[model samples]
Target: MHKTLSSKQLIINEALRLGFSDIGFSTVEHLAENEIHLKEWLDNGFHAGMSYMENHFEKRINPALLVEGSTTVVSVLLNYKPKLEQSDPEAPKLARYAYGKDYHFVIKDKLQLLFDYIKSDIYPDLEGRMFTDSAPVLDRAWAVNSGLGWIGKNTNLIHKKLGSFVLIGELIINMEIEPDTPIKEACGGCTRCIDACPTKALIGPYQLDSNKCISYLTIEHREEIPEEFKGKFENWAFGCDICQEACPWNWKARPTSENEFQPHPDLLQMTNDQWHNLDEDRFTELFRKSAVKRTKYKGLKRNLDFLKKK
Candidate 1:
């Protein structure tokens, strides 16, 4: 006789079938512990110019606040590890995550399917909302609570199998499912990510000073790149991935199975001259659906010009 799978198992199996790297469940409650850390991070002005992190304080720590009557937080991971890198050794680099379509749309669509599966076949009355990096949700914290992975010293969620090259999404619903146990912190004295940071942005283990981070300086920062960060960008014209690249857990990271995450044909083939001569029209064509569009044409040119100075 076959053993019956619980509601949690059913959901997990369905999520995996939908091509998610992994899925886990957790109880919805006030994240009291995270509140302190978040407050301290905000108090230190670590959020930098992204003042929006200051908004929705209550909703960030509690899922139920975002979705009424929510009792379960279903966390899912989608691997974004690329199969290839830029072919030109001298060309400015882009963070692997920005190579493909914006993850917000990709993951949101998948989460809706998962949500529909839960309601139509299982719960039938599963009222909830899905979220990716959007909204005030503390994504990494919830992933940890759901036993998806532990937060690495670099502050990225690191699944033992999927590594850090993964994106997280969630479904907060009214139904309760058995929560998964949290995993152990596995960095274990690895300081490669800290030492690998060219701008000293890591500051200390598990601490990131975003004001000095290359990813933040290149993308989220709207103003001119600071002079102090000159030459520290290391040819990155978009986002930086030094910390994730330095993590040992990612050494064995396999390429993602999701074709939607694949880079455009010309993306990897772009040469230094092509990037340097890029115009607004070319930029639009190359990054038509990519996350790289976040930086915009002018912003990318700014980064490219900055790299030339080095």
Candidate 2:
């Protein structure tokens, strides 16, 4: 005779079969501690031009506001680690996450499928919505609250077994489920991420200064790259993975299993001179399905010019 599985266990099992690396649940409670951290990060102007961060003060901390009668937040970590990175040592480097198709679309599709499959169950009033790196959700906080992993010194969710290369998604539903115990910080006294930053972006243990972060200037900022960061970007033309690269937890990260997340051949094989002379046509053809499209043609040119100047 088979034992009856709880709703939470059934959900977790299904999420795994669907290819998520980790699935943990959190009660829909106010995140007071997280709110304070957000306030401090914003007050210090660490969020930079992203004013939207200040708009959803209440909704971010309280899932009750986002969904009615929300009791459980099913947080899932889908690995987006690319199968290949820029091969040429001197080729302007792209962030690992951007090497493949845009994760917002990839992960959101998976989340919706999970939602539909769960809805297929006989529960009459199973209400839920899937969220993946969009909206006002504080993904890292929710992932931590869901006991998926601890927020590392670089402010990324770091799993003991999977590292920080995971993409977080959530399914907030009205069903009751047992929540997992929160993971403790495994970073200890190690400051390799802090020490390895070329721009000193990590201002403190877990705090970062976005204005100085290479990832921010390259991808988030709208105007010219700040003169102060001129020589500090170290040729990174997109998001920075320096912190994660320095974290010891990454040693346990197996290469991603998702085919859609593999790097485009043209992107992976670009020579240094090719990247230096990359034009609109090649950029579009190569990154047509990747997250690098977020930067647009102009943004990529802007980043490339900045790298050239450096």
* lDDT, candidates in the order shown: 0.91, 0.85
Model 1 misplaced stretches (Cα beyond 4 Å): 1-5
Which candidate wins on TM-score? 1
lDDT of 1 by residue, 46-67 (tens): 8899999999999999878889
Clashes of each: 0, 0
**In model 1, what lDDT does residue 249 have?**
94
Summarize candidate 2's per-residue lDDT along 1-310 as a digit string, tens digits.
1221365567778888888888988888999999999999999999988888898789988988988798889899988776566789998888899988998888888888778777786344789788988877888888998888898888889987889999999988887777778978889999999999999989888999888888888888999987877778777899989999999999668888988788887778899899878888988899999889988989988988888783
- Find the candidate with the highest lDDT and give its number: 1
- Looking at model 1, residue 169 earns an lDDT score of 95
TM-score for each model: 0.97, 0.96
In model 1, the worst 10-residue window by lDDT is: 1-10
Cα lDDT of candidate 1 equals 0.91
- Give the clashing residue pairs of candidate 2, or none: none
TM value for model 1: 0.97
